[model samples]
Target: MTPGLLVQSQGRVLPVGLSVLSTRGKRELELPDRGLVVGAVRPGSPAARAALRPGTREEAFRGGVIVLGGDVITAADRQLVDAFEDLQSVLIDRKEGDPVTLTVVRGGQTRTVQLTLDASAFRVQGR
Candidate 1:
């Protein structure tokens, strides 16, 4: 059966509306070695507006099914991003409406996607 949910619903309120897996998370599962993996993209959000997609592949991790094979975010604004925290760290300092550059690997080919931060994006301090 295809898995579905409300939130990782853990982290959000940032600029983008998508769930991602850190490279280390995949490493634990012995999956592909790379940057943060795109897990899910919220509809109508900036991520969706930018055409970010989730993968068709699925794997069991920590008693839950994790979607894989979408896009791997290798960098952001020329800065290395190997984990969720890395991406978060980059965006947290930027204001909404600012343009951010993301480097993503889709289907073994790398590309850059640029999108302006949405007003709905915010951060929970002390997280």
Candidate 2:
């Protein structure tokens, strides 16, 4: 069946329902129902050196600890990131080498992080 048709029939025809598959036959899905997207890390960049990459989920903690899910971005200036593309747009407005304070929400908690942009880094791919 077509993916669109399958999606429409999902949960209706079966208990688990049908799921759309990607070109490789893997099920495609979105990261956050609403949150940020982290694109890439620049070589020799502070973020990279700090072990921050893409697909990192940012969440706040009771102790104010910021956790980086490699590169999954979740929020900016307290603004909820619904998609990665949208978050990228906002990041683009700033310089690559600039350091910005990011508020991350993860695991039902919130934490702030100091993210330093790597001016030399560009997005190779995103989740």
Name the lDDT of candidate 1: 0.60
Q: What's the distance in Å from true for residue 66, model 1?
A: 3.7
**How much lDDT does candidate 2 score?**
0.41
Model 1 misplaced regions, further than 4 Å: 1-32, 61-65, 123-127
Q: State residue 76's C-alpha deviation in candidate 2, in Å.
A: 1.4
Candidate 1 on 16-67: residue-level lDDT in tens?
Answer: 2223445677556444454666776667656677777666676654434556
lDDT of 2 by residue, 59-102 (tens): 33222222234333456556555444444556677776776655
Best by lDDT: 1
In angstroms, what RMSD does candidate 1 have relative to the true structure? 6.9
- Tell me the number of clashing residue pairs for each predicted model: 1, 19
